[model samples]
Target: MIKENVNYKTLDLHQRDEWLHFVMKCETYDVFYLPQYVQMYEERGEGKAQLFVYERRAEEFVIYPFLKREIRGAAEGEVYYDITTSYGYGGPLYSLSRLKNDDDFVREFRAEFERYCKAEGIVSEFIRFHPYLETEAGLASYVNVTSVGELIYNDVTKTEEEIWSEVAPSKKRRIKKSKRNQVEVIFIDGKDIGPKEILIFYDIYTETMDKKQASSFYYFSLDFFQAYFTALKEYITLAFAMHEGRVISANLLLKSEGAVTIHLSASFKAYLHLCPNCNLRYECILWAKRNGYHIVDHGGGKEKDDSLYKYKQQFSNTQTNFHIGKKIHNQSIYNKLAKQKSKLVQGEQADFFPEYRQVLVTPRILSNK
Candidate 1:
């Protein structure tokens, strides 16, 4: 039930051209916002990807891409759903070509979004906002926002000397040691990625994950990589560090209009002493700089100040806050689902948004006296 004077449009995965047009019109957008990228997630059975567009006029609008997931057993005979960003940073991107007031536009967008959610049986929504864009702050009025952690990035626009100076002295020593060891870094465009490279990367990445005891979510299938390369060849780059004729480390770089994201990286455990990872990052920074990218984003760790986060901070001190947003449109349905979840799980779940989706805790049985 769209309100009067609220000009808007909704596009699904089938409408690729129209969807891409809107995304390209935005002044700033990342690979995560692309229809092809979201389609991959949809094909993986994550959800049905949909782009919601609210047009203020011909050239000004707000476009939000999200995955609509069905809530199983939420109600009898009636269907309900929840929306979430697809496994990465994303939120509403606005066209500021003719915008007068940022706050005014956001407030109006929020009201209309809420209405759409209600009409479509959307109970709640979860958003992982982009750190660079900082879109969450403006929605603080309507959405619940929280700072998750901080991410490190290098402003590639700076001169090469300035960029090098920002690297921690200790890391600089390691990078030099890596170069002295004859460790060479090479870049392969996604189009050039072959089965052999995919197998090598998969082996290294899975081994690293095993040593770290990473969550199952980090263990991606080989087919996923194949699909990724096929769908996003132009925007993907594989950087491999070779030592004495063997690939020792690899990093998957995702490129956008103005930024390059170090999406995933791994190295052989035995080669840690060579500091191949350090050299790879430095080379990647230089590559991004030469390619006209403004920033090289080294995403945050699982938690603040963790070993992973500390490693990224070695390259640059510049940091940005990562935030997440939560919104509940159908309070009654949300409460019902949460209550049902509470009966099944053993612990308090007040802290988890959309509590019904929290991991179930096994219940303990009490001995009868």
Candidate 2:
């Protein structure tokens, strides 16, 4: 149990320095937890980004960053909000190495967090837990945790040969075929990315999106991509697959402390047979290894073992479960909101949590990372 002396702190966007400093102190954290990353979403009117820190002792704490969005039409003249993690994976990042095993500390953190939420009019929270970090397990005892899917990642800490040896035979053939077809892969530092490169990526990415008939949420504006390249330049890489000197595919790699995530990727449909993406994936693993990154996260698909997930599995046999945490702080208010939503919409998806937000036109939050 936590003592009365223990305290918590909330940092807003204005406190970038303090927010980053706290995140840096964590034993492990993803780029999703960074202030600059969250600020992009905030600029897009996603919500007001806030960082919550619970301190057990000096250099021992749990830091959770989320966007607090106002719940519209939940009540009359009563403003209620719900918190959600950004598009990518994130949750409470613990500083103490042994914190995961300490049940009492997690329970206390939950109790305190619930109190804070109620006091702040935060009716609920939704967390997309980190797959590699496994941060969800720590809160499973206190929160509702559900295994959403499995993600594939390469253990780049291993030697290049070892990593290659683990690649699925069919994937190896496709990568080899790509090489034979002269599918050249190149890496561009995000700092070096400019208007021309952005346009090339935008054209190719949007083409793929259109082909897939992806939702509006997947179609990020060119300005958004520009801002992304600028804000996260130091930790970003643009990898492109070229055939006959034409850009055939492109991927955005996000580098964290020790892992590199394949953030967004797309390929020209005409070059699909050339297997440009396969070559791109293999080359990315090599690039990450050469650059000292320890892992390559090829995030999961919309559903478990879906086509996209199967495609990523070819790169690495290693897999990790992606879990999400859901919590409701104010049951009465939550029920009221759900009831209101039910009246507003004909059929609300029973599975969509915070049930109030299930309007017909509201885009379902799809996992992009």
After superposition, the stretches of candidate 1 with alpha carbons farther than 4 Å from their true spots are: 1-6, 97-101, 343-351, 360-369
For candidate 2, write residues 100-167 as lDDT tens digits: 77888888778778777977899888888988888887776677888878889999999989999988
Clashing pairs in 2: none
> Cα deviation of 158 in candidate 1 (Å)?
1.9
Clashes of 2: 0
Residue-level lDDT of model 1, residues 141-166, one tens digit each, is 88888887899999999999999999
lDDT of 2 at 303: 76
Residue 219's lDDT within candidate 1 is 75
TM-score on alpha carbons, each prediction: 0.91, 0.91
**CA lDDT of each prediction against the hidden true structure:** 0.86, 0.85
In model 2, state the lDDT of residue 172. 91
Model 1 residue pairs with clashes: none
